[model samples]
Target chain A: AQSVTQLDSQVPVFEEAPVELRCNYSSSVSVYLFWYVQYPNQGLQLLLKYLSGSTLVKGINGFEAEFNKSQTSFHLRKPSVHISDTAEYFCAVSRLDSSYKLIFGSGTRLLVRP
Target chain B: EPEVTQTPSHQVTQMGQEVILRCVPISNHLYFYWYRQILGQKVEFLVSFYNNEISEKSEIFDDQFSVERPDGSNFTLKIRSTKLEDSAMYFCGGRQSSYEQYFGPGTRLTVT
Candidate 1:
């Protein structure tokens, strides 16, 4: 079984300011990590994922995340944010198997103020 | 690019009534899943279907909840009797392989 924890329930930042959203997970085995974004009245959109090869993963909208294995963390970051970046972000994990069922964290609401 | 599509963007139903949420997955995808998010809550997986059968399901997928792939392209989630707690946004997803899953816009189901 896999579980994800997103410590911050909400994060507020000014436009053009850098931001980071923390996420951690617990699993007995290797797992796949993913980040998803949900805009107001919209569906979940895949932001990025970490399967293997790289510790730092870059995603759409100038966002990126780094997978820290020793710390069991996969934190999302952006050099600068825009008001349009205001949305809910989720961290999810799936065990390294064929099931592909994802366990998600309680999302972090990003409020990018203009 | 092909994407997963869901029908009836919003649905209102009386308590104890039945409702069916529909989804059309991306072509050539073999796996499908259903998840729900209550207001201000995390998205929770309900079930996963593959090879025309349920491959995995969570405890939340009770007897009242059932899923079927009626046609080759359509996937449906049927609630035998809805309750106030069942009100939430339901999302459908399809995966082509083992990687990223494409999600539909979702159907907001409101139980009165």
Candidate 2:
């Protein structure tokens, strides 16, 4: 079974500041990594995914994540955050050869303050 | 871009009442799934369906919880008797084989 862990519960940052959300996973087999965002009272939207190839994956809203095999991490990063970037972010993982059911992290709430 | 859509964005029900949450997955996708997230909690998988049959389910999907694909364009989740703990945001998902799953906005259920 693959499991995901998001290290932080909340991250507070000022507008135009850089931000990072850390995520780690454990899986016996190869896995796919993903990031999702949810605004207040809204459904989750896919931010990006790491299927294979390049470890660095870019996503919508100027988000990017690096899949590091050595550290078992897939941390999301944004060079400069905007006030609209405030939302709940989740990290998820699924085995490459298994069912579509994804294991998700607890989530990190990004508070982009002015 | 095509995306999954769910119905009855919010539902309120009494204890022991039946509720059916509906979803319309992206066109041409073959796999479907249901997941739930209680307020301030992580999302949890409930079940997965493929080829008109349930492929897998979690312990949370008890006898009272059932899923069906009544037609080509719809997937439904029915809870026979709901408890207060059943209150949560339910998300429907879909994907083509060997691809990332797309999520619906979700139906929020509040059992009073």
Model 2 clash pairs? none
Stretches > 4 Å off in candidate 1? none
Say which candidate scores most in lDDT. Answer: 1
The lDDT values for all models are: 0.95, 0.95
For model 2, give the interface RMSD. Answer: 0.9
Per-residue lDDT over B1-112 for candidate 1, one digit per residue giving the tens place of the 0 to 100 score = 8888998999999999999999999989999999999998999999999999999999999999999998899999999999999999999998978678879999999999
- lDDT per residue (tens digit) for residues B33-99 in model 2: 9999999999999999999999989999999999999888999999999999999999999999766
Using Cα atoms, each model's DockQ against the true complex is 0.82, 0.82
Candidate 2 global Cα RMSD: 0.9
- Per-residue lDDT of model 1, residues A1-114, tens digit only: 788999999999999999999999999999999999999999999999999998999999999999999999999999999999999999999887647888999999999998
State, as a TM-score between 0 and 1, how close model 2 is to the true structure.
Answer: 0.98
